[model samples]
Target: MTTGNSGSPISRYTKDRKVGEGTYAVVYLGKQVNNDRKIAIKEIKTGLFKDGLDMSAIREVKYLQELHHINVIELIDVFTAHNTNNLNLVLEFLPGDLEVLIKNTSVVFKPSDIKSWLLMTLRGIHHCHRNFILHRDLKPNNLLLSPTGELKIADFGLARAMGNPNEDLTSNVVTRWYRAPELLFGAKHYVEAVDMWSIGIIFAELMLRTPYLPGKDDLDQVDVTFRALGTPTEQNWPNVSNLPLYNALKVYPPPSRQELRNRFSAATDTALNLLCSLTELNPGKRCTSTQALLHEYFTESPAPTLPSELPKNDVAGGDSDDDEPENKRRKV
Candidate 1:
């Protein structure tokens, strides 16, 4: 809505056009005048200097500035509007996000498509883990697909860099559906494994074309996850029983393996097996992003599709007509 000076250093190369908006910031399509490069500019409301910019927005900028990987969205520049007291973040503009693509396409993805996405997503998250960064929020909406169909993990608002393995951070992180079991059970001393859980959920979503476990609330979410994967036993998730919130709820016996196989009938055995390992109810038992990337699932036959090789436009048809109501479609 508001345009700043064209000649200013911060706004020098970028021409802004509105693209997306959210509760805390507005995203714009920005083009670099000199290079003719297009990028996404996220403008955060910063009039209230007393409270400072939102921590989530600040966290995104800080970590993304340090991370460099092809699977991660690139942060091009940072700017601030002089008179309006707004902070602007310039990012490489992705053509569309996975949510939009999945909704638009009727074409069924071959196992290769799923493998490519999973590989890319895990690689991105693995990069974060290597740097001690954890992407607390990971979901379809947060994953952007370039016009060529290469998947890039975006939106690091809820991401954090862990300082010490033993230190406990805030428990209030991650989106509910993609949250790890340790987080759900109120474990603040989590590791990169948390992001792996989300990747598992994303992997399952890609394969099924639907959310794997959609819980109405935190309690219900944990219930659904455990029900689908079977409750964690002492053997499977050792420290789970010691979590702060672990005792508040009654435990159910673990579900039969056949039940899981039946529920995800369309998934290949390797895919289902990996999902189960990643989504283990105990964070300790869950597979790390790096380990999942090395699994047999990705090593079969031809390598996954590279970013430049994916279908560009109209790969399917148009956006799906069965999109959920605006209010019900939760953003990560």
Candidate 2:
């Protein structure tokens, strides 16, 4: 794939403007000359590290190259510009993300609209899990919306193959807000439920239009989680006592599911049931992505709205086609 010796993939597109910037990379809105399709180019900064490529970039490239699904972001191409100290990734340009949509108070998403986004998000995640990959980091911002309103999982930088039993993996992979209790308790050998927990939180955020557990820090995250969901007990989660940091977890009596359900009066009872399953404290019992997709909430009266007909918002990935204002650049 090393094209530095000859031709470069960078020549095929016309970069229109910068879309986003981050500590590791800069994103540009570009168009392929042959077909004029829009694309987002993420140029990874290499000068900060003595190594040639960032570890997250390596992980992203390795996994995305192996998996292809409609709900996941497409990695169009990869190459390094000869004159620049960067690794550029050409990707499908999305209009906006769920975060911007959720944060836009002026926009009111119906139950079906929320269901549609959640359905697509789960489908994308299910694809990742089916292929033995774990998306350790899952949050509203990482869920990008295509112009058609289809939700696509993006930012796989923290994603990786699942850890087998008896092997140790980092407990600190997910963002603080969405980190599961098992991860908070420092469980080394965990499963894909970690991501499911995050999905549950995202579900709650969709319903409330605010973060479910907005902890100020890791410790605060754990406290808010137990208060909002429930503290894991050995009875509820059999292996709770065995986790590395179990002793450190606060001892809060589990909150009633009904109390939590009352918070989302606008949602159907079935919706609450699905959220309950996804947010279950026990990693062993949390709803799998497939179960989520098959949940009654989807088949109930208000079926998930078709993506193209959902509410519109003006943000990156909000609009599906041309005439969308060129995406504005901002730091990720």
Candidate 3:
């Protein structure tokens, strides 16, 4: 586990196996020779750009190195492989994630299970916001679950620092389905509330066990969001129409919050209220992470389950747990 002049990161690990692949990098499941601890090594593809390192790689390493929390993925080490220009990121390996749990029909999710997952997800986002960093991406797939049932937020490639009012940001940050209304309207100077909206959608998904809004394109995304939560107008979201792309959106009659209740009948009053606050059209009126943590939902009946008590299937992101079909992330 030593980083010598050769800068070979693979030298310290063994039993390398490819777990996933993306446009910019490939992930491998490996173990530390010294401690036999498992790890996820992200190998960044080189020679794709004129610059030395890819921007996403740089941003991921920079922000992840600074963020340290139980709900956040841990960046163990970073080094390049010998005889190669590629850089590798050593991260704490998570067995599975929330998406897998949701897709696993074998696992029945109680309200308490959803509460536990939401609490931990909020905790992670709270940590990021408290540090003034914005996790632009927040979806079920990005919420990694450890073997102990602890949830960890992963993927910092789209994350950036907040609180700079003068800096312009791109609205096309979050994934299409989970993107906030403000971003869809082309609001450049957005805040952390963007992530909050995604969390709200995730909460809804947790309750329903299906994607609340699966849009095919950008317009369809906005259309689907408006249909579910009601379209934002000048009265609801001040200055929203002034955004660059607001004029492109078609008109939609605002639906009442009762519609949301009907859709998520499984949610309690307190839980429903929290989701409403999170998916507020107006960022100014949206609930912050701190406020959401104190919501009455946490104190209600069927309290959040203990991490160790969560449903444990033999499947833990690998085939070793052959109790079920091998769940594989085909295109993450």
Candidate 4:
């Protein structure tokens, strides 16, 4: 299938089967015709609206085409069908995602495994942030896992470049559970800290095997987040009250070190430190990707597992847990 100029030939890939469908695109599991490399073709329905191409599709192509990193999903090709005129994005086919592994009751997650995943995730986002881009959505589901165990960040539709200081960004981004306190408070002038908060929540999820702050709705999200991390007051978060929606919140005291310890029983002191740094109430105080990568948690005992050695789904001839050390096995 050929298209207008500047398009790759759709005939170069075979659409094996339909895997997923979204509001504007249908994803098909496919492979490259020449090398048989697995790929996912996101067929965008360009004719759906009078606006022509969807904005998300445009953003995905606009950004993914420029990013090239091992931890980021590769945008292999972009082409339009000769007859259908549909915009198709060819992406690396990641068979699993972090959310699937986190939800699977039988699969075990060791501390090293969590560290490894977190490390890879940070590496990926560090690349993005350094490029002045924001991965506005960073839930577990968006972090896809390759067959060889490398974790690659995906779903760039919600992503955008860092805006100017005077620019106002939408606070209505990121999933409710993973949304940062700044976003909840309606801070339009936010930065990379928002993504850090999502990573903190995902880290907690890895430890707890459940969502940390599962707010029912936006209003409830405000209550749920502060209740767990303490209400952001003028002292803890300077200029917090200046935000549009930062009024009349219940004043919950910050949890003590012991309290945090009890909450995350399995986490080491260094791990807890990193979590707190990431989820700090004040956006300015939250750790940057560089600081997080340099944290003691990653360098302390029980080193991060090699990507190839990290735990994965049992769907493909599961690993022999019998030979694993006791410390390496997750205690569920």
Worst 10 residues of 1 by lDDT: 321-330
| Candidate 4 regions with alpha-carbon error over 4 angstroms | 1-8, 316-332
- Could you tell me every candidate's TM-score relative to the true structure? 0.88, 0.92, 0.92, 0.92
Residue-wise C-alpha lDDT for candidate 1, range 170-206, written one tens digit per residue: 7667778888878888887888888898888888887
Question: For all the candidates, what are their Cα RMSDs to the real structure?
Answer: 4.6, 3.5, 2.9, 6.0
Clashes within 3 Å, all models in order: 0, 10, 0, 0
Worst 10 residues of 3 by lDDT: 321-330
Name every residue pair that clashes in candidate 4.
none
Give the TM-score comparing model 3 with the true structure, all chains together. 0.92
| True lDDT of residue 288, candidate 4 | 97
Candidate 3 accuracy as lDDT: 0.83
User: Tens-digit lDDT track for model 2 on 5-34?
Assistant: 235576677677776678888888877666
**lDDT at 236 for candidate 4?**
80
| Pick by lDDT: 1 or 4, better one | 4
**Model 2 misplaced regions, further than 4 Å:** 1-7, 315-332
Q: Total backbone clashes of model 1? A: 0
Candidate 1 at residue 69, lDDT? Answer: 95
Candidate 2's error at 107, in angstroms?
Answer: 0.6
Instruction: Give the winner by TM-score: 1 or 4.
Output: 4
The true-structure Cα RMSD of candidate 4 reads: 6.0
